[model samples]
Target: MSGSRNPRTAVVTGASTGIGEEYARKLAERGYALVLVARRAEAIERLAAELSERHGIDARTLPADLTDDADLAQVEERLSADGTGDDAPIDLLINNAGRGEGGTFTKMDPDTIDAMLSLNVRAVLRLARAVLPAQIARREAGEHGAPLGVINVASVAGELTVNPHGSVYGGSKKFVTLWSESVALEVAKHGVHVTVVLPGYVRTDMTRDVQDKGLPDFAWIPKERIVRDSLRAWAGGRTKVVPGAQYKAADNLLRVIPRSVFKSVARRFG
Candidate 1:
């Protein structure tokens, strides 16, 4: 167990693959009984089974397309119920399910952009909204530890809305990053911690094509590193995490650049 008072139940979205799967595995090792959510039932089930076998933790797989309001409602319902004993609470919630569609702004279809933002931004915001109150309540009652936390997996693309073919994707992640920071401030008095994981590029299937597309050296980061760094950052209740060193420096640079210069620089990546 991470700590005597730490949460035992952790709910992770997008557990079918990549960072989400890694979060599920590591959380189980730390003694969390996981509720794994993903659109693909078989993948989440297999992952849940493997985690259970390896860690001796209870893991439930829920196939949920968060883009669907109905599916998100089911997750909210599960979180509201303390399936565990009253003393144990839903310790952690990892909102990691997101997708992207790439093209020039003019070339991007409206429906595709809507779907991307819906999954990447709206769904995450809604899920966080659904769970935060319970977490705050548990904290106020002195039932959870230092920070009953939520980690929203944003991207470094949010830091500099500059990537070619990533206008909508970048905007969506920026929205996630901004909202998470605001929520962190709003909920700290209640002891509910919120962290944003802003990764650059990782070796997930989602970025396989980006690798082939001749990514800059800064954007090249391995998935294992992302997983390790994110776990460490979330545990620390960091407001934001930039996994890659190069990307971290780039993120720092974006903070000081003038808007006009930044917009022009953004066009290069686009």
Candidate 2:
């Protein structure tokens, strides 16, 4: 549907809630048969059923903890498979599962930080690796349209700009942003698009506490805006997307300032 020569299939990670769920919903609407991956089976299954019924598309769920090697492998295997006749090969991969390990670097628990890195960085990279071969093949075969894509959900905290609360989590996201853009360049010739979405705070289950922790309302971009902009950017084959206008300005500001200047601002603000 979405400019693809044929109907597409998508695998959306972290599909149980938040931006991932919205991606699943919107993709189904765009005529993608979906495979929703999340640790919580019931939530994702319910969502899949709802989407299938509403959109008249097949939606399946794969419940897996991406941090577990075996569980993660299952997702990789699924992405590797191009289903039998009339079945759509995966045309989109949304790497959205992530955890926020909040607090001062010294105060953060080692295990929590490890879990965050495993999901936010390692899983994202691995999943993108798993999907690209088939995506590239399909593009070369002339079976898909411009930019069969991957969307890695990075965060604005990863940019060079000052983020008062950003710490270990920021480092992990910076890896995502850079990795996605580099990969995008290598694959663009093959017509495989990759976008690293650098969204600021959004209203999601993950960010509920951040809202209560005195993060101002102005800093929040609603989930709808994030989905809309992310899809738009992905379609345009953008290397990265900063969903909100404020975050766009922040991204622009970060580009011009020296690291030393931003560091001074963070230290002063914190």
Candidate 3:
């Protein structure tokens, strides 16, 4: 909902690369002024400059690690800003920053597990909380001409039986999926939308190792498609989006198959 507002503003987290970067680019294409958040200062600054120059839109970079308490507080403050000053009210917030640790729950370093949870679960929840009040108020007061929303990037793994080696990561995403659905229901009456994107294997640096494992081409979804489909679904007021055709079929199969049968199959193949 790019509206009569002169320049709609969107805040995109993990904007340094991959799907986050794609969201920034696509939103810029739609003429949204962007606030790009990522830990890599240089990377996000470079991306901001490029997008600003190319699209003739304002693009600012906020460099912070979402897992750090101080850094997370800074972002929350930005999102909670009243927008009477230099900062503009955020029209959209994309919770795209997350991390995953390899190995089973017992084998992962306790600190690593904590960091992953801080990023994937705590940060996502806190940021959404920070942004929602303003959006709800705007809609209630009738000042929001365009859409006010949040799009949380989750994974298809969230809906499937847990991965023995990635239980925490999958669990975190399940929280996002379920939490987003609940929040979407709560905010719909207030004209605020929440969409959770559940993507399968996607072509990104995080999935480079899997890509090298020679999975079939259909198993990998392009990053662009995920962002595109996600934004489309959000604009249309849809709460959940599973972006790939093959993944859609797989998601359906996962739902119908009994857990005992899946566990048995995993014991043999996993």
Top-scoring candidate (TM-score): 3
TM-scores for every predicted model: 0.91, 0.92, 0.95
Residue-level lDDT of model 3, residues 142-192, one tens digit each, is: 675677889999999887665632888889999999999999999999999
lDDT of each: 0.81, 0.86, 0.89
Model 2 C-alpha lDDT per residue in residues 1-270, reported as the tens digit of each score:
234644578899999999999999899889888999999999999999999899999899999999999999999988876655544678789999998866777877889888989999999989988889888877776665545879999998888544544577888999999999999999999888999899898888877777788877889998778888988998998888898889999889888878788778878875
lDDT of 1 by residue, 34-89 (tens): 99999999999999999999988989988988878899899877766543545245
Per-model root-mean-square deviation over C-alphas = 2.8, 2.5, 2.0
Model 1 misplaced stretches (Cα beyond 4 Å): 1-7, 82-88, 216-218, 266-270
Error of 1 at 89 (Å): 3.6
Off-target runs (Cα >4 Å) in candidate 3 are 1-4, 162-165, 266-270
Backbone atom clashes (below 3 Å) for every candidate: 2, 0, 0
Query: Which run of 10 residues does model 1 get worst, by summed lDDT?
Result: 80-89
The local lDDT score (0 to 100) that residue 151 gets in candidate 3 is 99
Query: lDDT, candidate 1, residue 45?
Result: 96
